[model samples]
Target: MSFLNYLRVWLACARYSTVRTMMFRFDFIMWSLVELFWMTVNILLVSVIYRHTREIAGWTQYQMLLLVGTSMIMQRLMMGLFWSNLFELGRNIRTGQFDFFLAQPGNPLFMVSTRKLDLDGLLNVLVAVSVVAYSAHQLGLHPGFGDIVTYILLILCGLIIEYGTLLLIVSLTFWIVGSQGIEGSYFTLFEFSRLPKEAFRGASNVIFVWLLPVVLVSNVPSKSIMHGVDARYVLWLLGVTLLWLLIGTTVFRRGLRRYASASS
Candidate 1:
């Protein structure tokens, strides 16, 4: 299919799924309330911590809020768009259901990643943005156009890095079928992403900054907004994002060749 046609199909699928989700008003309300509660709790935690110390990990209270808010938004985006479906890749491959995806004319990865949409999670993104805006107001830090642009780019890069990392883990199912252990391990790594990487010390910190790169996903953007934009940091973030994308796509394609359908 042409690029425009592919985009149209994606939009149609998203719209239909959203309509279906809207039918469950009760579930949506409950989920939204719960998300709101969590957001409140997260903000409170930052407030309490900053009451004792002026800064945590070289960031002020407001800056930390920005970090937390941005991280929450990124998490919501992943959950709403990619997480629900990507996790099913392993099972589909094992059951031969992936054959349907293989037959699709559009990018199989894109199709699989966006097979489902969670509207509740999308709403959480709004909550996160609200927190970020409130934090910015409290800090009295008005960002410039360039800072806003870089912030947007960094957020996009963050999402891509997160999705790519999750896909890389799920792709391992090709070799390790029935690996429930992998799921737990993956979530554990993701949990680490919630905290500022600067909180970690020594080699562990080094690993997060370079190898895992989750720090760049959230902390860097928050810092850029709260502090000032650093050209070197932005360049490094772009480079890491591209590298991860290349590595992730390479790994997924290589694994595709070894994916044996259930019929085999």
Candidate 2:
């Protein structure tokens, strides 16, 4: 299909999700509040810690806040766009409901992953940006339009890395019985994204920064905001993002060959 046609389908799905969310206004509000509370607690924890210490792994409080906020923005985008759909993929495959996507005209991976939207997750993105802005203000930093654009683009790269990671994890359902526990592990690993890479020791640093893109995703973006984008860091992040995406789509397609449809 053409890119425009794919976009139209996505817009249709987005409209449907918005209408469904409107129907359950209370549920939407409650979920939004729950996410807001969670984000607020994270910011408060930073505040409490900074009360006693001046810096963490070479990052000052405001600098750390910028990092955390960048992590939040990437995570929020993942949750809003792909989390629900991908999280449900295991269950759908188990029950053979994944056949629905298989029958669709679009690519199965795109259809399956883009069918749902969580407004609350997207809403939290704005809140995360506010935190970043406040952190920048506190640090007496003023980024220009080009800098802001660069930061946004880097955040997008981070988002793609996150989506690819989750997709790869969920794709394991094609081989495993249940993926809930495995899916939960993604969040456990993600908790490290907000911490400065300098805070990690030898092994942890190698695993999170060098081996996996978990730390690199948020760190590179936040660092760009603090001190203009480094060409090496940008290259490294782009390389990792491309690698993850390739791995994710390759695994997903290979898994489709193993899938058993309800009709079958």
Candidate 3:
């Protein structure tokens, strides 16, 4: 198919899926309420911690809220767009269903990554945005036009970092098929993002900032908003994102050749 035809098909698929999701009104409402409850619990947890100490890991109460908000946004984005289909990649590879994707006209990776969407995850995103907005208001930190632009860019970078990391993890399924432990490891990674990066000290902090790169996903953005933008941090974030993307694509392609059809 032509490029325009492919684009049209992709758009139509996304639109149809979005409309299909809207049909589940009750599900949407209940999901939103559940997300709101979790957001409340997060706030209460932070409040309780703050009561015992003036600041946690050099971050004030509002700053920590922003970090939590950023983490929540990352989690929502992953769950909504990526997580839902990630596990299926392993199954598809094991059963040779990926051959169907390979036969598709468009990019196979794009088709695989966007095959499904979890609309309920949008509730978490909305709640997280609300928390960030409320925290900004309480801090009396009105983002200027430039700040808004930078924040958007930084958040986009953060999302890329997150998605790349998750893709890397999912790609491991190519080698470790039927490993139920993979999901648990992914969840553990998610749990790590809940606390501020500063909570880690010494070697552990170095590992998170450099090895895992989770700190850049949330902590850096929170710091940018609470403190000021750091050029070095931004550069490092972009570098890490590119590195992960390259590494993930390489690993996935290597595994692709090993995928044998189920019938075989």
Clashes of 3: 0
Model 3: per-residue lDDT, tens digit, 1-264?
777887787677667668877898787778767766876787899999999998987888988888888788877877777776776876687676878988887777777887777777865888788888888888899787888778777777777767777677777777877765575566677666778876888997888767987777787777787778888887888888788788877788787777665685
Sorted on lDDT, highest at the top, how do the candidates line up? 2, 1, 3
Q: What order do you get sorting by TM-score, best first?
A: 2, 1, 3
TM-score to true structure, per model: 0.92, 0.97, 0.90
If both were scored by lDDT, which would come out higher, candidate 1 or candidate 2?
Answer: 2
Count clashes in each candidate, considering only residues at least 3 apart in sequence or on different chains. 0, 0, 0
Q: Residue pairs in steric clash, candidate 3?
A: none
**Candidate 2's residue-wise lDDT over 103-186, tens digit each?**
899888889999999999999999999999999999999999999999999999988998889889989989886555688767
Off by over 4 Å in 3: 1-6
> How much is 238 displaced in model 3, in angstroms?
0.8
**Where in model 2 is the C-alpha error above 4 Å?**
262-264
Q: How displaced is residue 4 in candidate 1, in Å?
A: 0.2
Scored by lDDT, model 3 comes in at 0.77
- Cα lDDT of candidate 2 equals 0.90
Predicted structure with the largest lDDT when compared to the true one: 2
Report per-prediction Cα RMSD to one decimal: 2.0, 1.2, 2.2
